[model samples]
Target: MSDWGPVFVAVVLFILLTPGLLVQIPGKGRFIEFGNFQTSGASILVHSIIYFALMCIFLLAIGIHMYIGSYFFLNATVTPLASSSKSSENHFRQALLTFSNSKPTNTSFLSLTQIGKETTPSDRRGCCGVVFVEKWLLQRQDWRGQKMADWAPVLIGVVLFVLLQPGLLFQLPGHNRQLEFGSMKTNGKAIAIHTLIFFAIYAILILALHVHIYTG
Candidate 1:
């Protein structure tokens, strides 16, 4: 698989995890509704799932980028690039030194760096883990109010959530209510915890995958 295969999965995960896809604004008692049929609680659980999944997917992506960058760094030292030529060695050394002096910073508390970019590097790889993070989190620190284009991930997330809906149905067993899934009641706190656990499981799964790839 390519490096981005995992990323694609992560993106899908982000999209699926987008809250309010099936149920918008649960706080207002407005769940999934179509015509005279309506359903509740199912969307809350789904929204929770989405929130947690997004957190997990991004965390996993960060780890993968770091691991891949580390692999690249280790490979650079012993591979032909660094070992075969004095010029390459000098480049690697300079890159390393520069990286040491200007380490990357976390770009956003909500996320690591942007999905698929590294901000800076001493060599062509630049510092795989640092650049985007540095640029996003550190240099351009006003992350709370980014431009609309910058919110592409979030917007894409919403679209993905809508696309993942199983289908509209009127078979649910409530009075004039139809549901997307098994009926279940939830509150903000419960939904929050569910999302957290969802992301936690996802993070572990990706870490396992990362280990397999790294060792493979």
Candidate 2:
């Protein structure tokens, strides 16, 4: 993924999260339909800033998710943690530091992804516990499976952002006084339709921006 992925996520998350916040594309159409002639303005700018700040936050977090599955199998493993004779937890930190240029930071969050990439056997073999001479990377080329597994972090992050939205964090100004943007307080066909429409909007923006949620 490129920088655009975070930007797209930030924008969508802002529209979905802010209470009573109706959004308009830069050129047209109100998310809350009754608003008159929506265009770029303070409300939109502020919301953008809010989500961009939140994107910066996506880079925070000390990475408590330390240990992945142990190197009990040769069908997996990366160079860093695999490099040492013993697959200790500290080596993972060493790998992270190497990839992130000695230390992880908000800007280098994506560097962590490099640790799990499938490598050529020469790069991977003998690093971990693997004694095999056969190409571990080539033996199992499950492209679909690999991509889906790789997508977990992105999916989990998006789900967390969406799930956190309904708690009414703060009151923000919007065109709607009577209608809530995404209230879980009630269940109705209207809510279902609203969700579908929002998803459609998500699809549209994603297509328009040519955003790739995962590039590895």
Candidate 3:
């Protein structure tokens, strides 16, 4: 799994480095060229920064999902002592009482009470003896607001990813490697490759983010 992580990262990087895809902002009426096209030094720097920032965000999200998914998966498999014990007690009592009475009415009472007791509010409320009642109570207090709150993080992430330019993290490798606008040398081929990589990554992340925000 760990080996796969780095391999996946390399593949993503390679896709991002491929040349020649252009995107146009519909409302702005401007073309953002990708993949081996002639472009100004300033334009190259801005695009590079944007791509880098989006890549970092996508990596961070992947890390977070992995961590949270593991936690939930482990937690779900374990049973709590309190609930298990309570269930056994109810069953045993019902069995003993049913045999003792031997009447249909008494048998029905035992069955109803036993099942009801097992599933009562207090018994079914915790996760592996870890009490979630307080959390549940708190959520109820602002349930509507809490439901809508899910969109906030997704919205903010989308806004940041779109607004920021790619490749902000570092200068494009094999290029001039300079910090300033004039110092960097813009190779048409390299720029095109980088641009293509950026757009591909951008499209994938956006699709993933959309699925997450909507499905979650």
Candidate 4:
């Protein structure tokens, strides 16, 4: 099977397993009440940001792993050569020539060519072919920036949550009391739990991204 098959499957599974991404909007009976029983938009917005950020992280990890696994499978199935030593040597030389002569303008395009040319029998057959194999592997481009892009949403969400905390607190029905930074009235427990939740979600997102990118 091609690498894309497993990648597609993983992506679908990840999406299916994560439904919180779709639960951002307010629903019936899911309202946050402030003083005088008024609904708080700020509270809803803060919570939404937190949830969305977490969702982005989860998806990112899934993508990273999928790509990594796919690369492994492709590498394992590739055979260098099966003919006589001389013939294998000649083929390897030809394959190397083909790879060297081809100048890829972009990373993705170059990777496709490298994968196609290096996995063939001529270039990959014997134990001594390890160096060639490693060279081919190294030719693939890094997608770390892409992974970071996937994680950006989650980071933004965390920032938004922190910045809107004051408004969020005001929206709470019983938490209207404000405490000084050094005051004993501060609800450290609430703050801590909220921070922990965001971190946990971010971790999951990162894991998912790793899985997806690698497998793909």
lDDT of 3 by residue, 140-214 (tens): 235343432223233433343332223333324435453323322334444445445544554455333322232
The residue-level lDDT of candidate 4 at 103 comes to 31
Looking at model 2, residue 75 earns an lDDT score of 25
Residue 100 lDDT in candidate 2: 42
Residue by residue across 1-216, what tens digits does model 2's lDDT show? 122343345445645534333433333344443222233333344544555456545532321222223232122233444344345344444544454442212122212222544444543442434322222222222434342112323444354334333222211222344345432232223323434544555445443443334434
Candidate 1 residue-wise lDDT at 174 = 26
Cα lDDT of model 3 overall? 0.35
Model 1: number of backbone collisions? 9
lDDT of 1 by residue, 68-144 (tens): 32111111221113223454445445644544344222222211111233222332342223232233333223556
Estimate the TM-score of every prediction.
Answer: 0.25, 0.24, 0.27, 0.27
Model 1 has an lDDT value of: 0.35
- Could you give candidate 4's per-residue lDDT for residues 99-161 as a string of tens digits? 455433111211112223334453444324333233333423343322233334344444434
Note the Cα lDDT for every prediction shown.
0.35, 0.37, 0.35, 0.36
Q: How accurate locally is residue 136 in candidate 3, as Cα lDDT from 0 to 100?
A: 21
lDDT top scorer: 2
Q: Tell me the spans in candidate 1 whose CA falls farther than 4 Å from its real position.
A: 1-183, 209-216
